[model samples]
Target: MTGKTVGVLGFPFSKGQPKGGTELAPKELRAAGIVDRIQALGNNVIDHGDVDLSGLPADSKVGVAKNSLAVGEANKKLSEDVAKYLKKGEQVLLLGGDHSLGIGSLHGHTQVQPDTVVVWVDAHADLNTPFTSDSKNMHGMPLAYVVKEMAQFLPKTPGLEWCKPSLSTKDIVYIGLRDVDPGERKFIEQLGISCFSMHEVDKFAIKDVVEKALSQVDPSGNRPIHVSFDVDAMDPIHAASTGTKVPGGLTLREAFYIAEEIAATGRLSVLDMVEVNPKLGSPEEKEVTVANTVSVTAKFYGSKRQGDVPPNYVIPRPQA
Candidate 1:
């Protein structure tokens, strides 16, 4: 409760990938009592509401990357907002518009603590660049944008680039990685980013992996941390509402363990729960799944909401 303040920011932009229901994620999660859920967790919760990620022109002057303007614009604002909250001493919980939102969230967090290390929890590697991503989905390209300074090949935009180009190669770690494209795989190798794939989890156990992860965070024990979590990182059996659901992800219990340990570390600052697609789930199941998500999120934040808010506060944009 003392490490950081808690702020929720919802982003409804889901066009970053091949998904439609993510735009409805915040609304569905709200109905499922996300605010009340946080309130129940005993942490101070403030919902700054969702950022406006609507109304993008059909055409982007940029080639290769789809919806570059929309994605970039929303992320720019998201980054600014996230930066604002960290400045206010709030622990940021950025609800997913999609995984691509990580670019903005990380940018904002790093703007404050440029040395912050990010623990990326997702089923996919998320290391794909526009040139290599066969899917052409911007969701898969955040890592590329953040780590590739000259890689900001936004063919059309007039230099509003906030790309970080290789966020301290030592600063990024990957856990729960099982699915990855060949190009992304090569990039990971080329960058020397640490990754504990599902295979590693099987051989070494979650606790060991987490311990190794913390060691990688900062050998000096001083850098801040940002957790970029893709809900799809969990086994799809737990919540099959994301666009990129893959098999063999972390169990619910294991996820909570990782989060709890991170919270206890005091270095945990911002957390991102991305790729929740309400449109993909059945009505009743959607409600139940979202409730679980908020619960998991609260554990990472340490406590829940207070007297004025509901149990599950909508976690939209990251900046308070």
Candidate 2:
């Protein structure tokens, strides 16, 4: 088990999607005993109650980007919260409201670890800017705002001024991407971001894909890793509760292995498990999704089951 102190920041604020119940994810996950489970893993876990963005009006939408102000304000607050824990040398598990929370979670991570390597595991590239997003969803455009190369092309949204482009295209890697908009594709190709799509996963298998991904992002294997995992990255069978369901995606085993491998590196300092929407599925589906998400988080803290034998243990065989 990791010896690091873990700060669990539950961000139940979800204005990123055009739906409800996603904001309730933090509560549901907590109810499922995330804090207790992490504590059981021999790590010091602090539950920093769900972020308070209630003061921000829900009906507020600004410019071409729907809910731009609300999303921006919430992210700004979240950035401050995350930065606090990082400044104190504590690892963070940000139970996300939506994938849009990436704007804040990743930004806050960079405050302390400027050279952090982001492993963005999701179905969509999320590289759309306000000008390019046909749906005007802030979640789809988060990476565009944070990437320095695309900043000039994006218009200034209400709460985005506090956010500067902190991630160069090379500082991040994308995995489990099966869906991409035309604009997002063009931007990704032009910038030459390292992406391991579902096609690559099928061709090279997850292990090799992860190896190549890590090599691209952290060639020296020294920078801290921040894994922003969207539940939609999994196939609909495993994670049907998420809003965006791509047919072919990572299996439960593949997802867990990715998390475990990163944890083993001893450089996983931040995590964002986002986009598990309870309202989108049946009760059983919700349970499975939440359980799977929790399971992945467990792996992030070094839960390797039978393989995690006590290092100092010697078989106390009977004197035969």
Candidate 3:
């Protein structure tokens, strides 16, 4: 494992979604020892605390997007923060309020590494633009704002101007998809974006699927990688605490393998795990889901399940 400095940024704002309580994830995950576990892997973990967006100024709603003004303002700040950290060469672990935060995260990541590859792990394809969105929930429309083809359709909102198609369709791939919307499905098909649904995972297996995905996104194996993980990608049995639950999703082991494969590349720059809503499930369900999220995150930072030898070992007892 490469011991790069890790910057943890938490977005506790949940205005992007139509639900409540996802805003509590950052605090809960921190309390569950996310930072300390990364530190155990020998990486320097810096907790940047949470991005508070409760009192931020918002603009008028734009077109069909809900909370467009608030989401834009918050994402603008998040993008700036992400850019600053990446510029300093620190790997970022963004604790998200929802998948909607992806807009800001990708915007900021691309500002530093324009050719960064995005790996989206989710049951739903969040590729709906404001114009195509039926729910008007900004969380489901984040990818639309960051795709090159959809840029012209985006409104010229004040805080959202900084967002552009920092990512091309070829540079982005999706895994664990099962609940894609009709519009998103058409968009993905038309753009020929690489996607591995549960059916593909069962056919090709996770390892092969990941290898193929890497080949498509990082053919030369030199681009920076950003993984956006939505907890809903996991089967509801393993992650019942998330807002949107899909029945047949990735197993816990499969989810960890995905993170492990990305970490093994040693090119991972930013990781955002979102959509974990503690308020939606029972106490046991909440605990299990949170634990699963923490473990997957730890694996991304090289947390060896079997542990490892200390690098700086002085002779505590001299060998004879």
The clash count for each model shown is: 30, 0, 0
User: Model 3, which residues run further than 4 Å from truth?
Assistant: 58-63, 153-159, 306-320
**In candidate 2, residue 146 scores what lDDT?**
79
Question: Residue pairs in steric clash, candidate 2?
Answer: none
Better model by lDDT: candidate 1 vs candidate 2: 2
Write the residue-wise lDDT of candidate 1 on 194-226 in tens digits: 899988888899999988987976778787889
Clashes of 2: 0
- Answer with 1 or 2, whichever has the higher TM-score: 2
Q: Tens-digit lDDT track for model 2 on 83-112?
A: 999998899999978889999988888888
Candidate 2 runs further than 4 Å off:
57-62, 307-320
lDDT of the structure predicted as candidate 3: 0.88
After aligning candidate 2 to the native by TM-score, how far in Å is the CA of 169 from where it should be? 0.5
For residues 211-284, could you state the per-residue lDDT of candidate 3 as single tens digits? 99999888999999999999999999999998889999999989989998898999999999899887889999
TM-score, ranked from best to worst: 2, 3, 1
lDDT scores in order:
0.77, 0.88, 0.88
lDDT of 2 at 270: 93
Cα lDDT for residue 28, candidate 2: 90
